[model samples]
Target: MKVGIIGIGHMGQAIIDGLLNTMKSEELILSNHRINDAMTTYQEEHQIEVVTDNQSVINANPDFVIFTTPAPVTLAVMQEFKTLSAQTVILSAAAGISLAEINAILPEQPVALLMPNTPVAVNHGTLGVALNEYITDSEPIESFLQQLGDVFITSEREFGIFGTVTGCGPAFVDVFMAALGDAAVKNGLNRELAYQAAASMVKGSASLMQETNIAPDVLKDQVTTPGGSTIRGVVALEQHAFRAAVIDAVEASNG
Candidate 1:
């Protein structure tokens, strides 16, 4: 039940953080392409095996190997593996790379493409996944992803949209949260407390929406009284075309 990682960047570290909750450090092995002080400190703190080359991690024969490399070089790095076990399930977290491209390199391999947002570091990630034909059992893969956060399995065609909305979503939310925090600060609240309050409210609002399964507009209506401040704020948002701006933001990312 070994898990091999071919990059030790932020996403890779987040994956390791989640995997550690379910597996021992000894079961995880990583390849550090550009090791530095941070990598050295992380390795020391986690006590996980670190290798210099990609093949070393491959030679470890992990049941699951994830590639978190840059999209452009992901395939080339994958090509380093000449042969792998039929049971090995390869996953690419690099955006824009697809299963078909990966299959071109290792035609017989089972592969998947996933886009996990930065929230994964906090174990509240939104992940978009698509599997190829060779992956017969997804329990292992889904189970693996669940350790980090919620998983959405979709077709490759829709994966890009899912990636754009969720992958690019965190930064959008951060901007909104920061604005809220700035408002609070302008109103005299402490900066740290302002951000915490804004984040908590956002988290609670999202959870309430998910748990109640209510449409966002319906939820807004539920909170907006006929002449209340909530309605005033909602009206202001609509007047300013916030929704249209968000839609455009997602569409603009099609590149």
Candidate 2:
């Protein structure tokens, strides 16, 4: 199947990279509003076709057209392409844009809203997908999305919360890693070594949680034996309300 993506920004490029790395499509068409020099460099480096005009993307006659532009631009582009009959499925990766809003714009077409995080570039992304009432149990789309990453089908209302977690979670984890690395650096460890250790520990901890299927509290108990160093660290974290702060940050992002 042919797939066309509009607005080849960071997220759009990430999705295109995921698709090209996984699926063998008949054709992949990409377009951006600016078509700057950097885009030309990317096209040459990746051997992907780039279109300067928005209408060119619609003219590609893709089975699926993914709108990765910002919300305002996405609405405008959808309005422009509303007359195109060749585009069957409309997928929007824009945050804050609801499936209902998309349906209202294209009333006759099938629309799906997706929230895909940056980790899609590494094939480990967490994606939340919500389909309009027109789409029911589409196995092909599911199979296609699975190639990009782990896919979760959810209601539109839940999409914002899930998006905050999966979409914004990577940066949050990175912040924690950076803080750990900074602490290690203050202890006289080389910055590179500190970062390497911090990153590896985080990865291992995540893997343990995934493989064991145990609650994080149970795992913390296993490490925080009586009068241990881990217990001391936990006590400090509790004193500082670390968990509460993280929760508040997540909640604030959704708001």
The digit string of per-residue lDDT tens for model 1 on 130-182 reads 99998877888999888788998989999999999998898899999999999
Model 1, position 164: C-alpha lDDT score: 94
**Least lDDT summed over 10 consecutive residues: which range in candidate 1?**
48-57
Write the residue-wise lDDT of candidate 2 on 1-255 in tens digits. 778889899999888888888765347878888767899898888888788686786777787888899887788778888776633788899888877787787886878888999878777788888888888766767787787888998888888899999888898999999999999999999999999999899879888998999999999999998999999999999999999989998988878
lDDT of 1 at 45: 91
The alpha-carbon deviation from the true structure for residue 227 of candidate 2, after best TM-score superposition, in angstroms, is: 1.5
The positional error of residue 214 in candidate 2, measured at the CA in angstroms, is: 2.1
Best by the TM-score measure: 1
User: lDDT of each model, Cα atoms only?
Assistant: 0.87, 0.84
Point out where model 2 deviates above 4 Å.
24-26, 84-87
| lDDT, model 2 | 0.84
